[model samples]
Target chain A: MRVRKLIYLLWATAVFLAACGGSGKMEVTNAWGRTSPAAAANGAFYMTITNNTGQDDKLLSASAAACATVELHEMYMRENDVMGMRQVPDGYIPLPKGQTVELKVGGLHVMCINKQQEFMIGDTIPLTLQFEKAGTMEVTAEIRDSAEMPANMPGMQHGGG
Target chain B: MKQLLPLFAFLLLLLAACQSEPKYYGTLWPNPQEVADFTLTGTAGPVSLSDYAGKVVLLYFGYTFCPDVCPGTLADLGYVVRELGRDADKVQVLMITVDPERDTPEQLAEYMSHFHPSFVGLSGTEAEIAAIAAEYGVFYQRHEGTAATGYLVDHTARVFVIDQQGKYWLSFPFGMMREQMKADLQNVLRRG
Candidate 1:
């Protein structure tokens, strides 16, 4: 009877956890980065962040030991199809409650400039992300070749032109 | 009246076939622009459009500091050329820098070499660059940034295909497919 009762309690806990959401906190996933070309002084990283909390949060900054500086930037096009990439002015990206924020190519991204080490395919770079409410968290971004990435990523793999 | 009906049906079929002809990947200019010869300094010293007299030119405007857009566009072009294989030698890519103050001829060349060894980077005096840009219908401007971040340049991202005869052939808008471009380039080569 005690064993059966324990089993019931375990099942209840599993259900409770599921009801609360798989990860009821700020979480990062799909963390990936691109390898820097030989003459490239900079590299880029991308990922998706999910805010599974009831309160809003803000990503204040990011840091990588491999780079001299890490800046949040966006790639956009002006009128007449003029393309521009610039740093995010406020230096913070908002994370609304229960929403997911994606950082992808040609969109929001993390720019690692003046790299101390080259970002190569299959290598992992350690990054630290700071948030207003969620505090700081460290994540690893797996470096990938452009060919291995998606069409929207740094690699442009498409039908031959 | 019976004879006229059959003639009209045949005409309709011919029109449909014409419309079905494979479309070029890039936008075909209604009136292709005629490009004038221009000279600029590259890593290997003075270079001119006239130098590649009988070769097709893939012209683009960008800068080295551009981490995403420029590299992505160039990579797509590299793939297109690679798809051409032996025919790639008949084509040349010229990347003109919009940020003259920062992108010297040497810097531009070094940056471009990362994309494709055959790619060449061009830089010239402010007036010289402007004249060439104007002729190509390219517009560009700079945006300020932090001291550490330097600045950003916004410029036209279209790819211009200049035929071997030095005439503007087509404009490939940003985000065009490589396969479509390859098909069009193949047709261009076949004509020659």
Candidate 2:
């Protein structure tokens, strides 16, 4: 009877631990490359980051071997006549725990300036994203053709053809 | 008799010069073709190709966030529109947003004003933009990656011209000179 009671307690404790786990862990996805190599000199990168650890974490910055400079940028519309995209000097992107923040086209993106290397189809570029609390994470992004869509992540939207 | 012969020879020379002028004498490599019709939400209201009937239309497809091509092309369009003068009203310039999700009708209206007051910006659902792009034989795709931000899109860089009857007329290559575009526009207007 005591052994059975102990087993029940262990199960309850496991459930509690799972429920109390933080929701602010950072996850990155959906990176791609532009088609024209020369045009790739000033290319952009995109992905969705989800923070599940329940703690707010900021995206500090990004580094890549392919470019001399990397910047965070967001596109904004001004009046009824013009649209502009500018660099975000603040290296960090804030994410509330459990919520997903998306950096997409016509929105926020990572701009690779004066790329040192050309990205071709089937090639891969290494990207390292520094986060405030979660430290830094590395990802290898596949260079896709200009017409290929990012796999999964159906909620994402694309503009311009 | 000699004086009469000289007069006849001069008249013949004038006639020959006039006849030697060809019916058309412009570059013909960048010919126009038909583009598919698609619906999108315009700055003023919902717009379709049919709505701009009887006018020469300069159509460009781009997203607001594009740092280089979008603004550069619009600036060029602004110059062309200004050069049109009194005929500007007869020519409709349409800027279609490829990034419709973020570029709402309100956003499009604001974005259009930066280039020119007469420029019309349009956006709509994914399917709507896709259908229109397909009709024009435009190709685009979203790039996925491992950055903290989402993906970017790569698309064809071509401008389309439509005649008064709403038929595809011609295509301008990327970075087409303003003088050439103006000449093309004048020719289309004159033809109509």
Candidate 3:
């Protein structure tokens, strides 16, 4: 009985720690970066944001030391074959209660422009995402090694194909 | 009358099977036309379409500074090429710079090397690129971007497949699957 009670307490503590980000409301995971060539002026990163705030929240902005600045960007198909990208006009990504929002390539991404350093293969770049309720959370975006890069090639969507 | 209808349907099926034309994943030009021979600078100076006469070529219009869509498309093309195994050499993926001022021939070479060794990047003067782009139905325009990114270029991201005889064949739009691409390429390779 004593051993079982201890196990339950440990589990509860672990959950408490995880749910205690910012105002104790969000979890960020699967942050990854695309490989940046030596002379590339910009780099892109993607990740997932889970809102546990029990209320709707918004991601207002983001930043990273690896680049001079960053913006929450999205890609949309302008025509049958042309794709255009721009900053999220509403200025924030919506994170509804109990839902996970994914930022992906050819869709939503963190566009790090004016690179201060090259994100070579197998390196990590620290990204600071600012949320309305969650405050600021830093996530490491790892550029995977060549042999094991995730097959992130996905289709583009929104505003027509 | 029912018996006759069944015979009629069987005959139609047989006829349809015999007359089926070759299929491709991307949209085919209504009237495939021969593209004019054009020259652009490669890592090795002054390369032309005629250089790879008998091989299939995939042409792309993109810039090195483009962080998302361009590389995603290139990675898909690279996946198709690599999956072809030894036959990969029969095909080529060439990227022409939409931002010629930004993408140097050396930078293009290094960028292409990352996708696949056989992938090639081309550069030329602004006038030269514009002329070629106009003829090929690829369009690009310069514009101001956010403070983070100094500028951006909006361009059509279709991959045009040029056959061995130098005719503009099917064009693959952005986000085409590698399997479909591979199947279409194999069909082109076999038919030629």
Candidate 4:
């Protein structure tokens, strides 16, 4: 009986570690993509990254076959009040344990440049997100129309054009 | 049929008489104030607000990196400018880039060309941009991060109008109609 109890305790510990730190345990939610028409030539993708582990992890990089290059970017406003945006260097995004990070309009975003093919609504673009510890996870982002409001940003107006 | 023709002619005459009178479509914004004079770099060269003293001026503040709102507003302004025709010469459209760090004069020139040649693009140092934005009561904020790239900037989306005397006249919110803008310009010019 003592031996059996010890085995059960060891198994439970292994299961808990596997659930907290392993690649299969991390969670991602609210992924989306927008592809312009063939003529527009540029598109953007957005999503939220959630880290479920007790330990922190980092998002190393991302890749997609749909575009010539995939870049991470964020817009900036200076103390003097000018606004600008530039590409993120290193492409490593930090994710704290049990926290959620969002990429949306007027915020951190992923830019897909020089599209080889156009993405239309109701279609999905296959992407792979590389993490420092989570290895690589495959994701499919749904293409949305330009007029579509992001589900995360409530009270945002539409049909401004 | 012959008896009805005379009645129709009388109705047409009455309509023509009524059309000769100008219709005042309600005020744009109540209690409008005049915009102050300020100097900034333009696509052509250094230009002051006073340079457009005698013309109706449409002024909007935005940055080049804005993916949607800036371009859409400029496109609409281009359409309205074209609709004005010869009167377009009587009006000035000013686009002030809120992002001065990257929007050099050359960049401003290139970006303005994407919409209309007649439209003017302006950029200046952070201090200058902030001073003008404050004077205009525009609000903007920048998010900070260690991404080695820039952060995001959120800003107000109000377009201001200046009358012939360089005084703040009215304001158009986002998605204003071109016809409404044309009418407002005509009204301002007539008042002058």
List each candidate's DockQ score.
Answer: 0.36, 0.02, 0.31, 0.06
The candidates, ranked best first by lDDT, are: 3, 1, 4, 2
Error of 3 at A113 (Å): 1.5
Report the lDDT of model 3 for residue B36.
88
The list of candidate 3 runs beyond 4 A from truth reads A1-24, A116-122, A144-161, B1-19
lDDT of 1 by residue, A44-84 (tens): 78999999865789989999998789988887877767777
**Candidate that scores best on TM-score:** 1
Interface DockQ of candidate 3: 0.31
Proportion of true inter-chain contacts also present in candidate 2: 0.00
Which parts of model 2 have CA positions greater than 4 angstroms off? A1-161, B1-37, B145-149
lDDT of 4 by residue, B32-134 (tens): 6777788999756788989888988888887665544465466667777788887888888887877677667776666666567777889888898899989
How would you encode candidate 2's per-residue C-alpha lDDT over B71-138 as one tens digit per residue?
Answer: 54566667777898988888888877777765677766666665678778888888988888887767
Q: TM-score of chain A, model 1? A: 0.76
Greater lDDT among 2 and 4 belongs to 4
What iRMS does model 4 reach? Answer: 8.8
Question: For candidate 1, lDDT tens digit of each residue in B1-192?
Answer: 988998999999999997663557666766776789999999778999999988889999988777666776787787788889899999999998898888888778777766678999999888999999998779998888656568778898888889888889677777776777788888767656
What TM-score does each model's chain B reach against the true chain B? Answer: 0.88, 0.78, 0.90, 0.79
Q: Cα deviation in Å at residue B191, candidate 4?
A: 2.7
Error of 3 at B98 (Å): 0.9
The better candidate by DockQ, 1 or 4, is 1
For candidate 3, lDDT tens digit of each residue in A1-161?
99999999999888886676424568899888877666677778889888887778999999988887888888776665677777887868889988999888777888888888767767988889999977899889988422223242345321111
TM-score of 1: 0.83
Q: What is the lDDT of candidate 2?
A: 0.65
